[model samples]
Target: MEERSNYVLRDNNDIGTVQIADDVVAMIASLAVRDIEGVEACAGNMAGELMDKVGIKNARKGAKIDIFENRVKVDVFVNIAYGYNIPVTCGKVQDKVKTTIENMTGLTVTDVNVRVVAVSMPNNK
Candidate 1:
């Protein structure tokens, strides 16, 4: 009698091999925005903080990422420095997020939507 093996065969298909998770994209966007000069901080809700506690500091709650065909869309919420120009600062954040994600991840960032949730003003007497 011949002995039988219980091993299963594997498929070598490329269709399901390449992928990037939404959390990774969100983290990348968060880091990119943080690197900008005028950015005070990245805005996050309660859930975001919880994610950070689990070692996912860059995880964002309200941010959205849509991967379609060869393009990606990202939305980020941030708080800016009080004295900086809001429009200019937001533009910088948007450009950084788009360029960084596209260059690093090879994903075409079609849109970078930035929402200014708050402004941080310096304490003055």
Candidate 2:
């Protein structure tokens, strides 16, 4: 299997160029959303889901990262836990992801787009 070798380059004149993997930002976003109360899980697309089914776990599964001109745009896919306000929860997600990524990477986060893929209901006992 081949690996994706994508990186976000940050050049530091006094030191050296810093390379941040695209997957690293995605993983950061994934962890950021975990603390939200209404978040069920980071839900990836059909292909990612299929890969998960086969035990090919992806650290950056549900988050898509785009970098250009030293700025970033991220799309996060998630399943909301049942009985939470969608708007509020998504807003929280957006804020958390944007802030977390910017703080960690020192890059300007242009946008954090949240897509609610599903509403997870609890299984009856």
lDDT of 2 by residue, 1-125 (tens): 73554554676889978788777878898889998999988886664576467664452377877777768989888889899999999999999999999899888899998878788898772
Q: Against the true structure, whose TM-score is highest?
A: 2
lDDT of 1: 0.71
Q: What is the TM-score of each candidate against the true structure?
A: 0.71, 0.80
Model 2: pairs clashing at backbone N, Cα or C within 3 Å: none
lDDT of 2 at 19: 87
Displacement of residue 74 (Cα, Å) in model 2 is: 0.6
lDDT of each: 0.71, 0.81
Clashes of each: 0, 0
Candidate 1 displacement at residue 93 in angstroms: 0.7
| Per-residue lDDT value at 36 in model 1 | 81
lDDT for position 41 in model 2: 83
Q: Give the TM-score of candidate 1.
A: 0.71
Worst 10 residues of 2 by lDDT: 51-60
